[model samples]
Target: MNRLALLAAASALVLPVALSAQSPADPIFSPAAVRAHVEFLADDLLAGRDTGSEGHEIAARYVASQFDGLGLKPAGDAGANGVSWFQRIGFQKTEFGQTPATLTVSGAGEAKRFTHAGDVLVGLNAAEPHLDVTAPLVFVGYGLENKRLGLDDYAGLDVKGKIVVTLRGYPKGLPSEEGAHLSATKGKIAEAHGAIGMLSFGTLQSMKARPWARMVQMADEPDFTWVSPEGVPFEAAPGLRASAALNDSAAQALFAGAPTTIAAIRKTADKAGGKPKGFALKTSVTIRADSVSQRVTSPNVVAILPGSDPKLKDEYVVLSAHLDHIGVSPAKAGDPADKDRINNGALDNGAGIATMLEVARAMAQSPDKPRRSIIFLASTGEEKGLLGADYYARHPSVPIKQIVGNVDLDMPLLLYPFTDVIAFGANHSTLGPIVAKAVAPMGVKLSPDPMPQETIFVRSDHYMFVKQGVPAVFLATGYANGGEKAWGDFLGGAYHHPGDDMNQKIDWDAGARFAQANYRITRAMADGDTPPLWFAQDFFGDLFAPDAPKAPK
Candidate 1:
């Protein structure tokens, strides 16, 4: 057995004895209850619950009905009825037009051309349908400029009016949250450097995990972003003429006559404590893009259970899960009899919403009430770049300061009898200890993130809350008790695919246990006198909300 499995086995021996002494009251979490909800949400009738689609509306109404049945009050958009259970989120969708894009690199007495959507993928997030740029190319390492960390890829580079070529992420050994921040803002950094265009290539690790073909397939789909009612695009980066991601071959062509190859630069970036340097590429490139845009609205289902304590009642704890999925794939021939075209998302998020519903039911029915109000939010458009959560965070139904903490559920991968879980963002706040305490009596271990390089913390709905200065935790089944292989196989085979249907094997009991653990964590936070607080010197807290108060030393 692997080391993680051995550790899990060793822990399992002592956990039952420890848990047997403090079991909670009779079964509030039922596997049958969770499965029932999943069956309905993942049913084919819902048409995969695409954002802004009728299927998504059906799912939202279902969640609203559950909250109503549990006696939770509406806490969504203010309406003629004072408040409704549907918070409307407006979005603008952009689709790249089918104009054959070309990237031509010419220098060193040689030239190469790459076809868009194949050898490369290009798009503009702006509303304008067309953009064209011809400029000199310069390598900028990872294009991260963080003065505090003494890392600046553009320290001595002259990239103004040129195209900046960079890798997908920051160098190794940097804090994951910091790296995530740098990577996210790289485009802005390029634009700030007066670069007219940008070209990025995936790191070897990223490319291996998600192949170019899969990325190309998804790139063909429309991109959506939350927008204002006046139809103004939100925070669109200015001065970027064009942007594109190059395939491996296309990227390697940029360094044909340079002293260091792309491979060498990647090697340097991947090394422990290594920092790649920047240099001008011995090439010139031209890019052109075409796109179209439209507007749509989606609903975020929100409900509230008022707290019993007068002093703490105004504070709120959010239980969040996305209700949207990728929906049906574009129809094609040769699909297998069992292979439905719908990306049912039974595991991707039907399971998560089911867990959230069960948690809501348990909390609403409990005789002992929490001190803080609990908001059960079934967010829309998560698959479309966390639109619902982002909108809610920016335009909260309640006072933003009152929303103290968030617990997000998404794609838990309950394919095995998991004895441990990895709670993303747990270590950044006092929520870590609360999670530890809550899971102890359930014979479950709280494991550190096994794949920090993936930056899982910033890739989900909880990150929306984190960005708004809320302390949050996103829980997932961990790679313990022989679950590593299970998770890997699932991601490789079913993730975001039509295979994520109800036909896949799932440990319903594990789902129930997972919900129970989340319930305990939420209950502890609600009943506690103080809200969840950020740890002192946390990278995310300091970067996103420097003025927010920190936890007691």
Candidate 2:
């Protein structure tokens, strides 16, 4: 390709035409290699690559080997037994110690025990394996305690050593990031109030977005938390001993003899500035929690490509993809999909990891090395609430301050010929234009997040980096050119199911294109003069990176 060419036009205008240059991914990508990586990782022998399982360990080593073969430097923890490519993470898995964990509510000479899941769903007690608690129930509205927002549902309530009932989500209207942060911190709030237990029921708004049946379907799944170095799980919330999610029926049962009915509470919550007050309920719930926990370790396969420029070499850019998936579908009869037990996350993340590996290969081998260092983090435990990325962000091998940006690749829908890609959180930072530039050469436009209501900005691994004040974006194919239906179908059917295997119609060329686009983005972020920065006064930037640099508005 010519860097510059001149053509004489009919109107006597001499125009300089710039020929199409090779994409960063095209020169280094192999469709066959991409397919082969997914094949090996998604194989039945890997058993769905569950975190802390032997299969995920094998998957981590496989990624490390790929890095080693690509000549990338080891960038993990230095350990005596394990190699430096492995950042061994500690995890605790909890399963039901005794099934049919019962909840009995009694008050005012009336007792009701909801045994079926239709009324309530009992969660595994990951903090304490064996637990039994009978505490007075108090309705604390939404259980929020933010004084700055002038919202304090626990102001006049005495919930010390008692069970506090709350709504599932924050109020209907709040800033997206703040509301998301508040919604995720309900347990800590309960613990801070000296509450012994908590019960959360869905609100009308929340249930409309996500149905109750979906929650019950996943009630039997195990719970996991990352254990700290001291062997205690972070934020185990010791004071909050037992918890349960109630359906409408169970919520109504709790207010059986109380001052206000659950129906009235729901109705009040629906109106603007109309909220239920914190009040002592006439009921007491006896919760029996019997669960078992075990400590296990998994690794984040970390590797780096050294930078070329001396000054910028100290700065770093990260590329991340989760290597773990939900191990296997629980055995269920009469379903042919369940007959194949293994939940081969070929797209859920097998494809994402494969893309990262190829991008790492390209970056490491490219003659035009990037100015800033590039770290390829094949993370684990993403299926379990982005634990691995959180650990990496909080305890990075590299200096956290030097990590300029992160690009997360997770579950790129590869079933269609996508003309545009959505980079979640891109608009919040300088990465927005950078992303547009990177994918433009591939004839792919950068699209806005189609489903903002999903709050997908904080759902994936990159959001962990964002919380650490690093500018980050989660890149994936957008809903265009048959992508809408494809995404809907895959998420509805094969997502985390056994059907996401190599048997699907995976467009390898699309995979190659996606990998190439990411490579260009990583390259641009690494070699560009200015490090990525939060857009001026962006919500996430102001929330997480207030002291960090910001790009001009």
Candidates' lDDT values, in order?
Answer: 0.83, 0.83
Predicted candidate 2 versus true structure: per-residue lDDT over 1-553, tens digit per residue:
0111111011123222222345433464666667767877887878899998888987888888889888988989876765499888898888876566878889867777876365788767776667778899999998886765667889888889899999877776665555676777778888998998889997787798778998888777778778776666865476678889998777888887787777788788877655678899888999886888888899889998999999999999999999999998776667775378888899989889989987987787787889999999999999888999998998897889999999999999888878899998877899999999878877789998887767788889999998899999999999989998998899899997889998899997777778878888998999899999998877779878889878886
- Please give the RMSD to the true structure for each candidate, in Å: 6.6, 7.9
Return the TM-score for each candidate structure: 0.92, 0.91
> 281-352 in candidate 1: lDDT tens per residue?
889887776788888888999999999999999999999999999988886687667657888898889889
Which 10 consecutive positions of candidate 1 have the poorest summed lDDT? 11-20
lDDT of 2: 0.83
Model 2 Cα shift for residue 511 (angstroms)? 0.4
Error of 2 at 191 (Å): 1.9
Superposition error at 534 for model 1 (Å)? 1.0
